[model samples]
Target chain A: MTVRDPKQWRLLETGLRRAAENFAIDRALLESHQAGTSPHTLRFLRFHPSALLGFHQNVEQELNLDYIRAHDIDIQRRLTGGGAIYFAPEHLGWELFLDKAVLGTADMTVIARRICEAAAAGLSSLGVDARFRPRNDIEVDGRKISGTGGAFDGDSILYQGTVLVAFDVERMLRVLRIPAEKLSDKAIASAGERVVSLQGLLGSPPALDTVRQALATAFGQAFGALFETESQLNPAELPLYEDALAEIDCNDWIYQRNRPETEAPMREAIHRCRGGTLRCGVVLDEPRQRLNQVWITGDFFAAPRRLVVDLESALRNTALVDLERNVGRFFDGYPVQMMMLGPDDFAAAIRSAVASVPEPVDG
Target chain B: MQACNGCEFIGTLYYDPEFQIWVRREQNGSLTVGMTDISQTVAGKILHVRVRRPGTRRPAGKPVATVESGKWAGPVPNYFDCVIIEGNPAVLADPPLLNADPYGAWISRVEPTLGADLALADFLTGETAFAGYCERVRNEGIQCERRTG
Candidate 1:
């Protein structure tokens, strides 16, 4: 087989598809690329109303199965890591399959930053001040607009993201097991405050073609490469895709890690410090003794506001015993000016939330 | 145990620098597999680890376990053909142990299917080999933390 120039990348626009097909293609492309049978590629995909979970996540812990079944939302597990998300045709998915050598470093964090910055730049070109928030989020003025995650096999890597072109906060809250008690107007309004969409920001959704072009342009500029559109998967990837589809499009694959919701309880607490009131929401993985994710939202004042989100990112997946140390370390190096509060206060707030839950019994 | 550039290395273990995995042969012929300290540092604090169940045979370079850090996720591949014997329950329960005490937090135990001569032939061993590992650490600009109390 004749090899294309390494500097030239393929752009595959596999428009609207179910989560199964999209993920199968993800496997096929990443495997083919790793096997040296395909060129580095960028793929754009759209999901048909799906509820997706991270590869290692427990479906029961992350989603409201009753609501998902009632609404007929397709459930699938992502090949990458992160929290669960609600995806629909209104959301645009972007992915890159490339050799790790192209990034010049084996540090995944650096690679994530570079790719997120490029994607954020693409969004910024669309007239929003999109910025790469540390640890896999793109936010415009502190409101998340895109979330990204990645997976690697040997020397090959696949990094993917979802851009909220038009998002439904209520629908997302319903699909995911956020607080059921928070289904009231106050909660929906508060949920709306945390995320932003292109349609919401621009008054109307921009053309899909325009968004694709902006992203393609940004990637080309960032990596100094030219992209050529590919109509379909390469011949070698056909069998790979078929096998992947057969393996992925099954109930077994989707519910492989079926931990109970009781193992992961969402706990919240309010702590009033000298600086301000800090409210923290924590999803504690009781069996594993870890914190899956934490959301800190309150009337806290800090000079660099992103510090709160960064701290939350640092605390993600932290062992319950190490929470205070991690929080203290997070602030030790970070230069932040909060009115009268210190890192200990943030630690205290998270600890308070965690303390509300009973410790899991030893097996 | 010996240290280089703040990264620890056990003298008796064999190292696959490319994969950043260390293998220790037990008296019972099973081998213990765990990621090197440099790897845990580079990958950041690990979030979750899921090992393939016992009795599952895998070919060389196939994943024995999947590991996820806060920002990245990937596999912990075996360097040789082997059948998994057991996964470390401690590491499975609290993944941060891989970051805090990687050597103690072995990922899995596997019995190599390859012949003894060929099984560990490619792995680096001894003091001279460990020096090379340290050189790679320096060359890669790996920053291993001096864990504070």
Candidate 2:
């Protein structure tokens, strides 16, 4: 097999667009790259206010559609898979479309890490101490600044991430179907502790151009590629983009996986332990036997308070049966001091919450 | 079974190396398909699997189902044009089965619209083909392991 020259790459800055249009371009570019009709590229994009769902996610289960509809936020599905997110115009999106061979590995985990590290480095150059968090996040002092995911076809792959240049916690809370407690004024502060934007860290967000330049330079350094600026979609992609837009910008595509909200219900549990009380809120997907989201709160003394946040991250989208293993793996690698808490306490709290879900009564 | 670095390939099933899926022809002219063990190993801890509805006609190379793991998401593309006959409810409800038992947790049952023989000809089966498949796996440095909760 022959490899494409790493020295040649394209840099595209696709300014703000609607969710449907952005997702359509995603399909077009990925398919074009796979067909060898386009060059390896790095694209920067921004979106108008939108509530985006992961490809396999149900819009009804993931977003608070009532709020979104009232607020005029576009609802669309991402080609990539991960949890849902609220994307505002202030958020900057970056993506890399490349041949998998250039990465020197086909292992998706390794590929995600490599790209995220470079993106983290880019953010670091903009003045904060950014690091790549395992799975898919970029953080500074344990608060996430970016979240990433990927989708692949044949020999090509498209990995994308969203950088929160600025954010609106209240609007996001309204747009996403998170735990209701998070909507309270007090809990809003707690939500802020989990995610930080460039504005919060730097006092003022840098210009979008500067951020884009930093990322382009970092990627160039990492892959040893010289990026040539491209202003428009390639000829092959134009036709493809139109077709994708027609298919994607419709109710059929937006509601492709609209499972009922009843399938996912919020269940809360409180566990009393020697350390303290741990409150766990689980959004359970009963049919799939999966935990869609988990929120851990209550009186617990874990030094480097990020421990709870990171633990919660580990449990996201986790299989109920793998709860212990995931918890054990997270605790084994993390070095933190808890007043009277241990790894089992954390796991037990979540398990208790899961077990508390009432059995459905047959009609 | 042909094994390489813990990856197992059952001799009776035909394999599509590109898609990394195994196809087993059923008695009723339908076929059952699942991801190869190597693919399950690479995907790691399957999180979600959504299959196309039964009766949906899909062209070759189109997604019969989409699979998501902790870090990756991609299609389980059929190797030939086919109409989905049935999707495995067991795997749909419990995705980890893909990682725990790749062979037993078949993804979909479908009827081929194209000539089955021509499609089968493109797939690898038998001991000799398995040897070649294992050799390719070795060259790619793929290590398959069974992960259970």
lDDT of each: 0.85, 0.87
What TM-score applies to chain A of candidate 1? 0.91
Candidate 2 residue-wise lDDT, A49-107, digit = tens: 99988888998888888888899999999999898999999999999999778888888
Q: Name the top DockQ candidate.
A: 2
For every model shown, what is its TM-score relative to the native structure? Answer: 0.91, 0.95
> What lDDT score is found at residue A178 in candidate 1?
68
Q: How many times do residue backbones clash in model 2?
A: 0
lDDT of 2 at A231: 73
Give candidate 1's error at residue A194 in angstroms: 1.9
Fnat values, candidates in order: 0.54, 0.56
DockQ of every predicted complex: 0.54, 0.63
